[model samples]
Target: MLTFLLLRQLVQNAQSSSSSETVYLPLVTQPLIQSLPDAQQNHIQWMLDEAPYPALSAQAITVNLAEHEYLFLIGGGEQFNPQTGRLEQTSRVTRVELDENGQLGTWSDTGDLPHLPRRLHGFTATAVENMIFIIGGLNYPAGNSPIPRFNNKVYCAEVAENGTFDSWKARNQTWKINADTSYDYEESMAYHAAVFLNGRLYVMGGLRRGLYFSQSWDATRYVFSAEIDHSCEDLVWEQEETLPVPIRGHSAVAFERSDDKISEQAIYLFGGVTNDENDPTAVSYRANVGENGLEEWTPQAVIPGSAGIHAGTAVRSDEYLYYIAGTTQYDPKQNSARDNVYQTKILPDGDLQPWKALNALEYLYGHAAAVSTLGRLYVIGGAIVTNSTQMPLIQNTIYWTPLLFFSKESNPVGMVFPGEEIQYRFTIRSNNVRDLPGLVISDTLPTDLELVSAPNFFQNDRLLSSIRITLPINSKTWQTYTAVVTQPEIPVTINASTATATETVLPTNTSTLTAPATPTSTPPIRPTDDKTCVVSEVAPDSGTPRPKPTCTPTPVVTLSTTPTNTNTPTPTNTPTPTPTAMPTAVPEPVVVINVAELCFEGRCIWKSTAVTAPNRVYLPQIAK
Candidate 1:
């Protein structure tokens, strides 16, 4: 009965929603708590006994980049057997196909590793074209051997066109360092991070554990790089600059951006275990890949939510990087895993924006994650801690979710005046490995605005009533439409647009423009005192008004003659009248438009504010 209950609980947890609270904690020894109902106690006990453990320290990579790509899961500790009280690791290799509709097929075992005992874990795999490279890992000997050996060998295999891997072959040449000494430094490392870029293999920090109980484990900050020859036969390892701090159980990825003029590449390192084994560092770093080697490492935004996070997987899709589930916290008494997922946008200038959290999933750690060609994220085997005994149960399951990227923006986002033309730009980029087809973008302009011009691909209906277009994929398609604000009576107008792919889900975005009533000025009241003179004389040449002199009393003139008899004109003694200042016409107030970019979750839109206009309120349109 107990065994049956445990199995039932495992199945139920696996089928639960990704947002469900899957982490469990051990019970406390309190008398009041122990007095709780039996049903509640049984529920807690079920979570402890039934939750399936995750496959820890596995490596997953997508291969066979044809119409349908296959994701391969290789070498990890599968699960713990409660009866035997032992954790079981496997060397078996399995793969699943991703269909055209972005659906994953059932996982099937391909074959086991080509070595004695045929079991390994904590390895890193990189797929270059049709070839797959398996790096350093820990190998456990067959039978009841208590000690596991660290593997320094490199394995190569060719993935067949039909999504099957051929026979694996170990590289014969030893890693040559300085041509004077042939050393296998990688053999002493496991759980490190590795990435392949520009025909080079780069490996970062990992821990070296002693074979005996008396020897202490040491985490190293070493970094090494090897150039892959054209024939892919010979590789010479060269030591590069070490990391600022020694780390282990971290994840790394390579990003490359290219244009017509120049190409640049950089490597990013995520969270890992540093000097303290129990507490993981959330700090990340980025370094440029130059001709000589990696440049100086610069720190980036820290991962949020949890500080002691390690054994997580990081994958890049387009300009975004995702960090999947990991052990959230660990201690001698209790260890907890979490389903938290975080992502960050990679800017063009090689800087990372702040980390943003995504929807949660089942608690997992020491798992492997990959992004498929269909633009879907897949999380493979990982372990989960039980609430009763804190034992880990390896989970042999897979979960995936669809991913899409869409953004809409407008030029001159701020307050638009009457009779002014506004340009709206719609951009759709595909993060999928292949190009997507039949992407339709549609927008409806407010009644107060008029459409000026749009791209040839767009079909404008009745002077900005409705504009729609079908865009191409894998590129930023810009659609420009000049919208003229015709009516100033309407204080604010919103233009909402939606992008929908053939078989994809997307959100709607809106751009708002507030055209406050054109500033009006009242004509300055002219001064009309009783002494004022009215000008009504008409000019003979043009039909224009001529001003006549104001009526004033004449004064008697007096003159004084000089001795030389020179007739010097006497200075005018008439009292100078104070000039009356004409009333200054009031100028129209200047309208200052304040444009701001507002983002919620991953979607962003343009928001405009008229600084001169007061007490005006505008709200964003929420997508259902």
Candidate 2:
């Protein structure tokens, strides 16, 4: 069963009402936690197991576009029998799109990889610009032969909105695979880690076939750099740089930012086994990429525990790298895995602050994770060994946790029909506590797209134009820009690209009611108990019939009058009824009551904090 926690800020306000009337208040909520920088706060909340991938995860890869919180799970294998321990790979590509609210929707199949329909495991897929390039990978099929074959080919796919992939094309390679080079299997190794930095796809450490046990070391230590040529026909590879040790099952992450319009690029390497092939390493390495090529190789921190392989499935945000589940210490006897998640803070000098243990992952080994620009990390697909039964199993699971201060989504993206004006809701958020200086937001459109109008705020401030617009820092309002297809005959798609930037490199309710009895107020009974409510969005009524979830339509409030007691008190003469100036009068006390009800799934699950005048008891009728 898939399990996850729904964590939200719980808030509500109770108001006082007169005894003769009833009051209803809408729910109110407030932000519970203050914002912090992405590096400082841990997005380690209990992760959500999104709708699981449609396929099993023996060795699937997940690609996440940081700007768009979209996740793609591609190519994994399923074991037929537990006894044989055989793997079967498929060429299927599954797309998991996170809704605008950051919740995972249903999984959709986004076609298949180009060329052969083979399973891709242990290869690096890097997103450069609008396309993702899938490099050399192994295609292990369950034939009679025990040997597995790897592909020397590299494929590219165009990334479309809403998790759709297209334009699958293979890149031309210089290596001509013939009978002569077929023996040297290192030319096409799988299980390698990759990072794309400044147009360069850096491929590192993987394994290749050799003369069985009699052969010498078989791990490929050389890191190959692949970049796109001007024509985009094929990939250009630079001279490979050998690592200090030959490794495989490692992870490579390209982490950098823009400074003064110049790019600052760095790729970090973490966790892999040596040439011997089974022993994992906890050590990490780093290097800087410049115009010349890879430079300044630095051996980084060693994780505290035993050497771990597959640590590359880490989700990185800024300097913090969170290594989710992997093999803690590979066991030759029984394939042991770990669920521990470790955090390594990258320092300026290629050193790491001590690795801190965070939330434990449910599954480990061969999973993929990516942190969005908004600081949410998505973890998907892997193999896990359950504690109840220590048997290895394939997974099709997905989870996400907050890892940064900016949990809010910024990009204004949507789909529109042809010739329809799409009013893009442009939003700029200041993640810093201090005001950001000189902020600029830009939206670029194709020649076929038309800009309809400018926002009033932008026009009033003289920041709107056909080009880029400047936005004031800490502005919470969402500015709208209307764009339509200039030529309706053109194919309908996202015709415009929207972006928000800063000219200066800056970092980055309630209901109420009621009358009080003469001066004496109930001091609004503040219910110390707070509860959270989860509501689903309702679709608009269309001709297409979709069954409503058997919910009894809530009747709009319409009712008969509530009868009140108007009884007269029995007249009695009291001796002590001191008649001052031959006249005496009696005052009547005012009565008041209040109630709050908690509803769920079309019914009131709970009700509490109903207060009444000291001697009177009022039972509230819970909403059905």
Candidate 3:
């Protein structure tokens, strides 16, 4: 015991000598408390510095209609007819899936929103739990109508089983403008930002246009929070509080963080417009979510150069919030919002850290932004804002980014030639701050290739067409496959044609179309010995001649030379001519020409002779 105490004292003295360094003592005994002197602890902390965060490059992507995991840009006016300057609104639902890696994908169209396909814009789609609540946007314009009717309709869509988007169904609002319940808030406003936090839907900052308002438009300041009723079927809203200043075209993001002990959540507001404001508004405000209720709004950090960005959208990550492209209102006439992406961390003091530029986007307005559960940010359709167009010319373009902390690489750059043996390596390295799960990578080889060698970690036989890999977070692994390429052979095409006699000629020729049992090299000729035209034919009593073929070999030929007295031809016997020349190349199906001479212009032209022996078909001579 005495020796152990002396050694401990020596260790403490050594640690004290080095005040700039932090030394962890050994855990030799239970409940052994070790404390560093206050001065030394301070000095050690002063020497330490926080590590820089690793960032990956983001990519702008196009969305596809049939793909899943896409953030849907519900309804907006993009099909603008430049000729009439008439703005057309569509109820079309556009969707885009976020890539796990920063890669581009195309946007696709899906089923339209049910019910009347009203032109919808200036609305907010807030995802709460598994449901996306779209609240408050412009429904109809003053197209041959008395005034513009803003839609206060509330709709909610549940995420499908595989995380694909589903159809939205209308949910009736039980809340009203006044206690009398005569006026409904859901039917009167548009261009509002809505967010779902703490099991309640918060709708704020929208424009209500009607004849009742003095200026025909009201930038609503009243904030409304809605919660499901006991049956979870109907929504009950309460006009809780109002904003310090009501602004339209602003974006709000709800961020959940840890306060060391309890979970902390807050919503940050950035950029909007008031009635009198000339440019896009840049006011930043924050509201804290507490156990009892939401705290009062407090001013937070804004984007560095401008007041705030309007039309640009914002999405939240685990520790940071990203502000995407919107109209930059530094100049009202040239409100060109450049393609820009900015990010800021949610600090412990409930304040956002200094804004930093992350990526850039094409300038646009009237677009939407959404975030998937896997930290993918999607920027939906908006117009490319140049100094030229009077209206925000809409684009059907979508961009997506997968903010991955780790990096993946595959080797063997280009073409893998047939019969060439090669090795392919897939390496993944983790530089992420946190651990991740469901990290799967799938690779499918060409059909002809065969895998000869693979790592044991890569499961399956050598001939597997596809291999999937799932990696743990913050770890590195490599997979290699050695394969031999095998190219497939292509079959040749042949010309096959039918032989037919002319119909106008009465078809009197002995026409025989039969494939021979044995292939012949030359055309068939009549058999002759000296002056005697000897005829050799199959005997009538012959039953099933030897060397039978798939088709009977019938040949017809006529004697061209005059028959001498010693070479008289017999009635039942005919000499066999050589078989018709066999086709050298493979035969392909071809069109048959009429095998008849033209007797029309007073000239009766003929073809060849008739009767021959086995396996030969002959043509009769033409009398011209």
- Model 3 lDDT tens row, 1-624: 332354357445654552222223332221111121122110111111110111011112222233334444555664444555444655555434444342334545344334224556666665555555666666546554434466656676665534454456777775545432223365656766777777777877777654453646766566777774322255777765567786777778777766568678887887767755564446688988766556788878878654545666767755667776666562323656656667777777778888877534566665666565545455656665455546444555545543332221222323333566656544443322112333443344445556677653353442322243343323555555666656522112222122223322222335444433343344546554324233344332243232322443335454324332333332433444444443333321111111111111122211111110112211111111
In model 2, the worst 10-residue window by lDDT is 1-10
lDDT of 2: 0.51
Error of 2 at 332 (Å): 7.9
lDDT of 2 by residue, 1-624 (tens): 000011111101112321212122222221333232333232255446753343343233344454354556666664434455455666766656664334566667444423234576666666666566777776665664445577777777776654565556776665323222323543467777777777676777777765555543366676767666523457656655457777777777778866575566788877777756445455577777767778756777765563746534755755667676677544422456767777776665546787777657675676666654434567766666665344466666667653212211111222223455545443333321122233233334434456667554243232332223232223333445665544432122221112222332222112233333343322443444344434442222222333334333333332224323334344334333332332122221111111222222122222222111213221221112
Ranking the candidates on TM-score from highest down gives: 2, 1, 3
Please give the RMSD of candidate 3 to the true structure. Answer: 28.1
Question: How do the residues 1-624 of candidate 1 rate in per-residue lDDT, one tens digit apiece?
Answer: 232244346435644634312222121111111121122110111011111234667788888555557877777876654555445777767776765434567666444324223466777888877777777778766765556677766777777777775467676434434431222364646778899889888888876664455555555677788777533354566777678777777899898999997688999998777768555456588989998899888888888854666788888866778787787554411466877778777887899999877656677788888766434567777777667475676676667653323434555544455676666654443332223444444455555556677654344563221133232222444445666666542223222122222333234334343433433543444444335345554323242434555754444333323233434344443544443444332222112222222222222222222122212222222111
Clashes of each: 8, 5, 41
Can you list the residue pairs that collide in candidate 2? 43-402, 122-191, 172-234, 440-501, 440-502
Best by lDDT: 1
All candidates: CA RMSD (Å):
28.8, 23.4, 28.1
TM-scores for candidates 1 onward, in order: 0.55, 0.56, 0.53
Q: How does candidate 2 fare on TM-score?
A: 0.56
Better of 1 and 3 by lDDT: 1
Among all windows of ten consecutive residues in candidate 1, which has the lowest summed lDDT? 41-50
